[model samples]
Target: MIRPSILLAGAVSVFSPFVMAQDDENKPWTVSTELGVIATSGNTETTSVQGKIDAKQRLTRWHNHYIFSALFKEDQVTQDDGTKTTEKTAEKYFGSIKSAYQLESEHSNFFVFGSHTEDEFGSYETYSTVAVGYGTRLYNGETMQLDAEIGPGYFRGERVLEDESIQRESGVILRGAASLAWQISPSAEFKQTLSVESGEDNTRTVAESSLSTRINDAMQMKVGFNVANDTDVAPDKEKTDTMTYVNLVYNF
Candidate 1:
């Protein structure tokens, strides 16, 4: 099992240098919280909620970020007897922290990243990965910025079988990630992120795209779409799941 205390200690050790580099008066932390929701009624009754918090800190030669997100969904059906039955369709959460140390080359850095995910209704009950990789800014222009990273990683997960038994799988994986941001206007921005973990047994992929527009000094409105795919799944389980939602974001 992965221990949160160990992760916290590692983060503190790596970020201590950056902490000292920044002046106390002007802290380098940036934090944001977001909430998304969707509901449907009539022929099909469905509801979903998602929440996320992101925090980052930047210093002279290092930048560190932490992110936490959760998603929950439910569907309801009206029986012939006039009773409503509700079932939880999805529940998942993800947490990760990444720290990058700059290299001599421009727009290049080395980073250590670790993440944990749990899903009640996914093919996997829990999954964890740790990787160290080189990341580079692929493009930086007036209105666009893009970054990419690739590395070897370790993955461990417990898969849910059709018969309700859990199968533990652990192996080496190749991790790849890319992110792109576009500044559409003074108050509107678009962003996309894609991540993949390829192992001998299965390949897991996630893609997310969002557009956000400023609503006030600290609030923004956002629309996002996300897709997840697992190449290997239990019998009768689909390989893909997709979601669309609208959200409110608050920046601190």
Candidate 2:
């Protein structure tokens, strides 16, 4: 059963008149197929299917803006019984945009951003986070990237009976991600990723790595793993439970 909000989002997408009228030079889109698994400490494993969309446009000369993103599956879930099920799972979505300014040919790029994320197991909320970062081209084709931010944010829980804590941490945090794209042929590409994320109260650390291949102009596929830990995993209990998710992504 799809949630009301998921149905609403899809309806808006289908009826979005602006989506088709936007100038040829004004929009972009990406779609993908994703697969992954989530593990909690020594228990429960859930696998999932994932998909993503990204678009960009230059609103001005000083700031060539782009929104890079993706979201995927409700069930590709790996249950304790070791069977796959898509039932009772929730849909996930994420979108973000940034206005970047260039300072040099290969040395600097800076940006400010705002984003929204809705995970299969979490709430959907808007964020007005600001980031200043630098990017430099490396190895003639590969690139290195880094950024930092501070902001107030919101989150929601998926399970109604589960804990309901909406307001997330608000403080300075550092974010970094790097991907190496290998040009295999004129039309095909391969990518590898490395990322680390941290936030205030020294809470919630995320580390991830993945590999993907671009099969065509509209579609791509990925497989990866991610691990997350928090300072206060169980608010009422003294124990902390870490989570891991093995992921596969498809984009078109």
Candidate 3:
């Protein structure tokens, strides 16, 4: 049987990459790295880092946005039997490319994007996923906007647990995200996001909000909070497990 703590780690690890991959660029590229510490079950701690590089270019009558992300996790958790287990050190990579076609008006645009994720866990297990989505944005003011998207995806995943038990599961996935961005001024902004995801034994619903402040033309800092509940996520557990996390972001 998989432990509860290990299940939680897997849940958190899967969705953490979406924080920095949703940018829309106008030929202005971006690159940045972030580091932070997360408290894993009371006294144990996990260090998380993410690096991103993105660029945008125009393709005739349409514009394309391309962003790539990499994430690394280092941490340890004490198991239920009082034994210490270092959660597998894993590296995650992600790519999202969005393209929009102009519709003669500034506020009217349409786009479709594909996102890919690959996870490598120190030779224990690896998984890959691909999702494609269609969305539109309503841009008002200089930076205030709203964007919504929906997608269907699939996962090709296999896992090998510490007990030497292996499990293979892959199924249909549904995802949707809507974000509202408010530019308070030239140097500050606020954002609220709603995301829904449904997978095999997991149906996750999350709400997040963030605040961003620019330090200069080239750098920005932000912080956000996420509240989520997982229903039927693990077959062993009958009820939902609600989780909350605080995150900080940097853009350069």
Candidate 3, residues 1-252, lDDT tens digits: the string is 122332131111222233333254543333344333343443565655545555555545677677776667677767899987667565767677777775666444566656655656421244444556666675555667898777887655555445545567567788787879898988888989886767875555668687767766545665666565555323333233222333334443
Model 1, 55-88: lDDT tens per residue? 7887788989899999887888678999988788
Score each candidate by Cα lDDT.
0.83, 0.42, 0.57
Worst 10 contiguous positions by lDDT, candidate 2: 5-14
lDDT of 2 by residue, 121-186 (tens): 432232224445655445563333333323333222222112644545455656555556666655
Off by over 4 Å in 2: 1-49, 58-87, 120-128, 141-168, 203-232, 235-252
Better candidate by lDDT, 2 or 3 = 3
Candidate ordering by TM-score (highest first): 1, 3, 2
lDDT of 2: 0.42
Highest TM-score: which candidate? 1
TM-score of each: 0.84, 0.51, 0.58
Q: List runs of model 3 lying over 4 Å from the truth.
A: 1-47, 54-60, 76-93, 103-110, 118-133, 138-143, 151-174, 199-208, 226-232, 235-252
In terms of lDDT, the best-performing candidate is 1
Go through the candidates in order and give the clash count of each: 0, 19, 0
- Candidate 2 — number of clashing residue pairs? 19
